[model samples]
Target: DMTQAASTGGMMEMPRASRGQAHLKLAEFAAKQLRGETRVASFSLNGWDTHSRQKRNLGAALERLSGCILALKQGVGPAVWDKTAVVAMTEFGRTVRENGTGGTDHGTGGTMVLAGGAIRGGRVYGRWPGLEEATLYNRRDLMPTGDVREVCAWIMRGITGTGISDLETKVFPGMQMAQDPGFLR
Candidate 1:
């Protein structure tokens, strides 16, 4: 998938096995960490900035992201997977509409994906602010309907049984979290 984008710089080119190798590698590493010594693991994937040619750019990025997620699920195996909760988040959102170059610009109200057997899948969570022009953040990007920190806090609470008091003050200072969205199963 990434081979196409990488070899030709967003065009179909020769197949390259080495293209986007980090996805599966990191996934395998995450799985090993979970199986061995680590309880919480974090890794990152880049190239999400689509300032131009968004379709081609995002296609490869999303493909790699998908592969990484799949690799993580497979590598962790069912036993560990059942208890695992994986999250992938970006720092900010993209513009609501394609720009002059058919790409997106940086803005606010981004998203994160949460996965694991313990998660409540098959649905989109959080309140949506809608695509109407009036609702966009700065009238350009997606307006956040809820606090992202709350989502993370709730996930932490669901996994570690940490209390709201500490989560608000210690883990995430000055956060006033909402009631659980029931992401855990």
Candidate 2:
């Protein structure tokens, strides 16, 4: 019944055939949100390893990510999308410099993508740690100029009205909430 489940729940009507299974599921989740059945959804897309052939491998992964975001927006409709915040983050970063294999090794600083109408879109946030060799972390990775947790804290504060004390003590332990970056509308 797994296949049946995948094709059900508003999946068959997905406008884009190129979307993968994960994107279909995300679209279904967005439909549920539109119906007030749920307020949150979480899913993951794999194939981001990119130990080599980064240009081709990473490009494909990014295409799938773009499709997933589009599916979410299309499923939710304009009204719900205006209240949605889609946060995409990787657990780890890659080295600033390419390696001998034409790929990057695991490193420190990574990028987080925020989309949807709920976000303060069209602007990149965070301090720029230049790619200069001297500014690299341990001379290997990009130096983390800001904590990812702080950005998430501010988003949580904006979306849910969560207080700073709880964000520090409970939600994101050991994180010192910094100045609000106004990530959300």
Candidate 3:
């Protein structure tokens, strides 16, 4: 469901209808490319940085993201969905409190979303570091409980059938990769 559009300088815009259509077209393209070949693929999206008046910006971004996800589910059908894995993430999170500009400042920690039938669906993964005054990092951001690399290693071994030896020493060095202790199973 990854789609590209003509960039309007730094302000690219695509109508919702067009975006949906692009999703369908891209799905068709992917299916054709993957015909009689591999079952695994990775995709990414960008432009999530919001520093001012983020409510609408965030909602719109998430809406488009969700739409792409649903489109993929429909595009691949049930069998593919059973083996598919979708992981979405941001490089960093922002301050818990809105800034003077109605957005947030750069801060540590954010969230990642995993989708697909291979994943344990309808469940929120990760430990919740409470937003209490002292719990916040630098008194402004959420604390990260899980090392993201551990999550990746777990995914590799459990989902892709990568050997533990490969995952630890070859794929992720100095990671001491452990079994996924979360809901990915």
lDDT of each: 0.80, 0.78, 0.67
How many pairs in model 1 have backbone atoms within 3 A of each other, for residues 3 or more apart or on separate chains, i.e. clashes?
A: 0
lDDT of 3 at 89: 72
TM-score of 3: 0.78
The TM-scores, one per candidate, come to 0.87, 0.85, 0.78
lDDT of 1 by residue, 1-185 (tens): 32222212343222234555867776776676667645676667888999999999998888888888888889888998898887778888899899999999897888888888879898998778799999887889899877778888999899889999999999999999876789888
Q: Give model 2's TM-score versus the native structure.
A: 0.85
User: In candidate 2, what residue range of length 10 has the lowest lDDT sum?
Assistant: 1-10
* Residue-level error in angstroms, candidate 3, position 111: 0.8
Candidate closest to the true structure, highest lDDT:
1
- lDDT, candidate 1, at 114: 87
The 10-residue segment of model 1 with minimum total lDDT is 1-10
Those runs of model 2 whose alpha carbons end farther than 4 Å from true positions after fitting are: 1-20, 30-34
Clash list (residue pairs), candidate 3: none
Distance from true position, residue 82, model 2, in Å? 0.7
Pitting candidate 1 against candidate 3, the one with the higher TM-score is 1
Global CA lDDT computed for model 3: 0.67
> How far out, in Å, is residue 113 in model 1?
1.3
> In model 1, what lDDT does residue 101 have?
99
